[model samples]
Target: MARYLLKRLALMVPTLLGILLLSFAVIQFVPGGPVEQLVYQLKGRGSGGEAAGGGSSGALYQGNKGLDPERLAQIRKDYGFDQPAPQRFWLMLKRYARFDLGESYYHHQSVTSLIVSKLPVSISLGVWTFLLTYLVAVPLGVAKAVRHGSRFDAVSTLILMLGYAIPGFVLGVVLLVLFGGGSFWQLFPLRGLTSDGWAQLSMLGKVTDYLWHLVLPVTAMVAGSFATVTVLTKNSMLEEIRKQYVLTARAKGLSETRIRYRHIFRNALIPLLTGFPEAFIGAFFTGSLLIETLFSLDGLGLLSYESVIRRDYPVVLGALFLFSIIGLVTKLLSDLCYALADPRLRFEGAPA
Candidate 1:
């Protein structure tokens, strides 16, 4: 097992390098640079002289002429934006060797520091959503499977299907309208991490306040993922119920509940475990993009969206790389989990 894990870990380096190269190439070839994005933002803010008509185009050109040309060149040189694509690629590769992810042009902050600061919020949201998804989904799925063809099963199936069909953003909007639209019906807060005066609370009060703010965003994020887990669990349990071991266990005078829970449910969960990593990682990053945006949560997804619009290559690349690494590692962990859960997967000379 250790050897298998080490081998998988070793393969990640090349895979990550390939991803970096492809990402870098795409970013480099995309229209507009960081400077263009800066200029566009400045113009939008009514700061650009040309946009504001504070100076004629020729005067602006002459003003640029008076600017220190060497300093301008040095800025480009320092960023490697002046270098050719091939040269810049090599420079980036060299920097990667030193674990330097570069700096954000817009924020003027180290990419690492920026991501680190934002990561906790995303992780906090993801963790809560994941917990809620599994806690609700697994039991609901088991109930549906056990009571198959009953009214309970039918209603649950219908609800799960509807949840799956609806987009997360639409769901978020519906939730917002229902809970946050009116003063009388307002059960949930609309935005931000906490209500005003939260900081003045006692420690327990602070914790309660934090949880109160988390409820809406976490609910919005969990809905789609919960549906997915429910469906998968229901299907897996249904299949496990039909298997011969379940019947044999019942025939051996096992209690109905024991046969279902101990024999069937345990085996049924193996397939779900195979998807656990994908579900967790997807929930952590991809699942909450729309929900986060709708709720105005400052998460990695929100940051990445803003970075892309601003053409912040360093921020975009850094976030993408971090997400990719997480996904790869999760996949690796899932494989190990499969081996641990199923004896068939543990054979030393097993076929690849």
Candidate 2:
């Protein structure tokens, strides 16, 4: 297992390098990059003022317009705009190697610092949603499978299918309208992850304050996601239950509970292991982009969204790079879980 894991880890370097190279190539080749915007700044022309770095940059550009060609060359060289793609990419990789992700073009903050600052809120919301999803889905699925073809199963199927049909963002909008300061219940805060003056609150008060804020967004997130897991769980459990071992256990006078849980659910859990990484990843630390935007939660997803809109390339690249690393690591972790769950997935020397 250790040797197999080390091999995979070694392979990740080139894989991640490929991903980064592709991303950098696309961003670099795309029109209207940071350097081109600086051109607008230099010309003192407002080709959309925001892209030109606004009034101060325009003034700075105007001041430098009368400078000698040598100064202009120096400026371009300083920013690496004069370099070819290969050199630029190599430089970027070198910077990343030293953990210097560069400063945000617009925010003027270190990219690492910016991402770190926003990561916690997304993680907090994600973890709560993850826990909620598994807590609700797994049990409901088991019950549904156990009572297959009964009224309870029928009702759950209908509800979950309905949820599956409705996209998460659409459901979020509906929920916001019905319960978020609309003509309906007006039961929850319209946006944000905390109330005013929450920082000044006592510990328990702070907990309640955050939970109160969490209710609606968490509701939207869970309601949108839990249905799929419930279905997966139910199907896996049902398949395991119908296997010959389950029948043999029942014939051997094992209680229904023992056969269902010990034999069936245990095996059923193996298939579901594949989903754990995706489930946790999509909710626990880095998903719910639309939902976060709707609620005005300051998270990495929303930051990436705004950065893209504003053409804040450093922030965009930094956020993407961070998520890319996390995704690859999580995929590796999922493979590890697969081997742990099913002995058939051996890492030792084999026929393969």
Candidate number of the best TM-score: 2
Residues 1-352, candidate 1, lDDT per residue (tens digit)? 6777788899999998899889888876554455433333433533232232332233334344445667556656756678888888777677766768789876889888998877777877877888888999999989888888999988878887787787777877887888886533688888767779998999999888888888877876676776778878888899998888888888889999888888788888998888788777876676466777787778788888778766677888777777788889999878877876677785356665
User: On residues 1-352, what C-alpha lDDT tens digit does candidate 2 reach at each position?
Assistant: 8898898889888987888888887775454556555555566655534553444345445545666668667766856778887998888888887878888876788999998888777887898889998999999999999899999999988998888788778888888889887767788888887888999999999999889888878877788667878888899999998889988998899999888888899889887787688668866557678988888888878888877655567777666666777788888888888887877777785743
- Each candidate structure's TM-score, on Cα atoms with residue i matched to residue i, is 0.87, 0.88
Q: Count of backbone clashes for each model? A: 0, 1
Worst 10 residues of 1 by lDDT: 47-56
Model 1 TM-score?
0.87
Q: Residue 227 error for model 1, in Å? A: 2.0
Q: What TM-score would candidate 2 get against the native?
A: 0.88
Residue 76, model 1, lDDT: 61
